[model samples]
Target chain A: MPKVTRYDAPRVIDSGSIWILVAAPTIWAVHFLLSYWVAAVYCAKSGSGWLGGLTDPRWIIVGLGGLSIAAIVWLGMIAVRRYGGVFVVLEEITDSSEQGRERFIGHVALLLCALSAVAIVFTVIPGLVFDRC
Target chain B: MRRGTSILFGVLFLTALGGCDGRHNWMAGAGEEAAAIGDLFLILMVGAAVIWSLVVGAAVYAHRRRAHPGLEREARLFVIWGGVVFPVLLIGALLVWGLFLLKGITADEGDLTVRVDGERWWWRVTYETPTGDVVTANEIRLPQGRTALFRLTADDVIHAFWVPALGGKMDMVPGRETTLALTPKKLGNWGGLCAEFCGGAHALMRFDAVVMAPDAFETWLAREAETAQVAADDPGFQVFLDEGCGACHTIRGTQAAGPVGPDLTHLAGREKLGAGLYEMTPEHMARWITDTHAMKPDIDMPPYPHLSGPRLDTLVDFLMRLE
Candidate 1:
């Protein structure tokens, strides 16, 4: 029999970790929309009203945001309808076998570490290269 | 309740941090306000990032050490907090910031004016000088300390006007007019290129934006506006007019009324010839007159294959002396 960590709402909610992935698409969408608005203003001001024909970034943001939210919501709905069994099976298997849990945690940690490294490069490298110019 | 709210707030804060660009300088010129607006939106993104990191950090902490039975109940609260409250707040703030930026950019009363037209593979820059003279050329020049208003349009396909140091890009679409504004504060030449891929030689369609002091620009304007006067009896000068070379080019004075190509009224005074391919030297002028296609391949200007030997030398001499 698989072990269940009770049906405590607080424990389940506090233990769930989806914010990082969620934030990626959300932040990018906002950035895209903002860029679109900025570029649109320039185009409109350019006195060449024909720029209105090009595809604006706002539409992309909306489409991406809608898709991401829908996917997350759908996943959450499936997880709930399956009565915690959706993740319980995977977690129980990993927890019972130390090597399995280590492997899973190690994979996630490595991915996060790589992402953090990339973010730092993107954030800091431009300043170093363009500061004098 | 507290943990749930903290997670939501954490996520927003993380977003705000991620969107920051440390190299952002102050918005200085005409189209600079748009950058300022972009900065505000970035602030919102940073806020979101901060919130995300904090929320995820707390969640991980809770997962590792909090073995309490009520965790699932807490998860419901956290979800509601993030899924509903956080998005509502985040989007509301974004909307407000976006509106503010939009207003700043759209405020009327531009200080300068310009007209940019994109052809098949080149840019046509027209500056309407204060003295009622409209100077048209491939390169863009601006007098420092003055706002340059740009009216962008395309003669063929779409092309984007971009000068990274000055401002963001605006597209030039066919059959329509788009307006952009820029005020080049510094006194130096800037590189400008077409951001859109138009056709063959698109990469070669480059232009230099010469930003000069106000006095220097005025002096240049005075010289540019002067009539090109050839001494009445110069044989080589007559050859220039008679060879039909004047038919496709313009000289401020004399009978060269052609507007099919670049204005050569003050071509001798420009820093480069053949659309920035060669230097402004007498030898380069002769070579260009002898074989323009060899220097700038695919140029619209036809090569003077017939003007060779003495004819080429005399024509180069006459053109070089036009200044």
Candidate 2:
């Protein structure tokens, strides 16, 4: 039986998992277009819509893009803190199945946090702070 | 299992980061302004790194001891210090430091005046010489240990004239003159670069400040003032005139009256060609004239890509003999 330690325990950490953490916020940040598309679709489908007319689509996109950028940044920071710690733990933990699971969970959490931090910080915050382009 | 591979990757990343330091290394006596600014920037970065390392080390030690494992004390302290005191003090200090540096550049000097105009990719340096000759463009030959008052302006967009060894940067705004003064302390070929990003060829916008001894500078100036005597009334001279080089360039003694390009009165004497791309030589001059864009992409100087062979040689030879 392998010794249970945080470092070498369940090593499910790979670049793919890391990228999922990276891509979530990136997709969400750019999702403003979907909102506009939905709004337009609703107007066309139901023969109802004055909201899109009053507000320029340009402003709407810019606002959404800014928010997404902020969210991405926030997610990135969380990811950095979490991922940075997991790598540190890998050196110290004794390898055991149970410990491996814990380490794997921690890695996932860190990846999620980094993604969230980056998304929010880069996308959402800037949207709130600055005027819409 | 691939421990060595991970370590190698880490090492490679570190090496790449190390290379990001600007090419202006202080290993040897290079540009004066670059040396000063680079040394200061390095010192500040190293100091910050040391401080951060110490703080991290302390935090690690505290964490290992399980001192406030729940981080109650740290949380409260972070809210108080991180949220308020740290930002206020840090930002205040930075503001004060910036103002102090600004004062040094803007010190009152109402005597000396030299207009330095920034174009798309080169410095249009016009010096109001004592002999009333407003020497302009490319090479800036100044007597060592003399204060120069530069009125910096741009013909197009904003650009910065900075010689880190001599003094600070002055923004050259279109339709406005920014002022900066410097007294060169050493006598060597000092480098000056556009600190501002202008366009595609901004990186290549480099010039040299040749700080010669007072007597040597005088001799060079006197030699420059003489009308350029072409070594021969060669066909190359006719090629130069026929090529419409005269329309946009000025050769002091010849029919070349073009100010749209750099003054080529004393072309042979200059050390660098095409704004520091290549060393000034007969061969390089020909190569540059024949195909300027190939050597430096997006330079304002249009390439005569069509001209080649003897036509190129004669034109290059004629320009090189401007001494």
Candidate 3:
């Protein structure tokens, strides 16, 4: 949004849809479901945990959590660069331009990434908490 | 305080203390695991109290302060420290402690092994000895100070075997076997129960966990191993055999060898009948024979209404002599 003094000024901007808002939490939601479901189904099939050298649900959940956190971090970097994702201060953008809207979206997405990362950690904690199902 | 009021207070205090002796009291600390669990519960309670006090104190201190601009940074630090860092550290520590506790309690080895199979409304118990498996029912008698490992499973449905005073509960899955270890420190009868609701008689399904002296337990096990001594010409034994009771019940050392129900070889020896629902006595036995559902609703055993008067008495006498 630099000063356009001439009529023939060139500009390029992101034309992505609003789906970016849900992308971060979607990872968290999928992780949450898969974590509990995997644990439950495995425990049901194998009975009590601590099976001798078998598939451990704890490590599986940990790996899933690590992947989720990594994905959130990548999204977070994008959000911070575009929207100034300081996280502590949330100032409203009143500009109705496309850039302003994109910035707002990016800011919201950044906050969501943080929230989702925290939520994913919470989900992973239960995986560590239980010794057996 | 007035004398009457003091007396009332004393009575209430004594009554509260009396609640500690109940068979299913997890706080009784009768077993090694229960004692450990009790200690964990105490630690958790104390930790929670301490955390609550600290948080409240912080909140009060913050509330009483003046609203200066300089206080904003301090307030943010307070929120982050008290709200975020403190809880994460405390809960993480507790979780680690609990995981270790769980590891310590869930043992893989024991001095003796007892296999318990959960039936619809009863328990079929078998003690694994070097000679062979000594089958029994309803009542589980373990030697005090020795760890008794229980291999538990269910016949048709899922049931949770919980002797609260002894240790943590484990589920009895139909196709899968779960193991639990109980090392009773005290010689007493701790109540065991079916914590999971399986069917109509789920509430009635229970067992007597009797922890005895080591020598006494050995003697009891020896006596229990022997088959019931059934005389050839006993009229009561004749009534038991004639009434088809042998089809569903087993009296070892005799022709009545049925594996469908609880073993009745030492039925009278058990303190409780109908799976710990009633006292093991002649009156209860007679009633149980005539109307099985009256003692425990929705049991698999059918009532014998026609076999009344002398016939029922003879059968009851034969069963009572099983001790």
lDDT by residue (tens digit), candidate 3, B118-219: 999899999999999999999999999999988898999999999999997889999877888889998899999999999998998999999999999999
What is the DockQ ranking, best to worst?
A: 3, 1, 2
> Which segments of model 3 are wrong by more than 4 Å?
A1-21, A40-59, A87-133, B1-20, B56-66
Best candidate (score: lDDT): 3
DockQ, all models: 0.02, 0.02, 0.20
Error of 1 at A33 (Å): 18
lDDT of 2 at B89: 60
lDDT of 1 by residue, B73-157 (tens): 6666677677655775566556655655544343333555668788755666666657766555666777876767778889878
Superior candidate under TM-score, 2 versus 3: 3
> How many Å off is the CA of B179 in candidate 2?
2.6
- lDDT scores of the candidates, listed in order: 0.60, 0.65, 0.85
State which candidate has the highest TM-score: 3
Give one digit per residue, the lDDT tens place, for model 2 in B1-323.
59999999999999987754432323223333334445556766886797689778868976788555577766667655664557556654544454444544544352345677888798776666577665557777777766667778899889998765566677888965667766666777767788999999899888887778878977887787667776446788888888888898887777777888787788777888877568988777877887788888887677787888888887887777777
lDDT of 2 at A93: 41
Give the winner by TM-score: 1 or 3.
3
* TM-score of each prediction: 0.57, 0.58, 0.81
Q: Which ranges of candidate 2 are over 4 A from the true structure?
A: A1-133, B1-23, B26-43, B66-91, B106-113, B164-167, B183-187, B230-235, B299-312
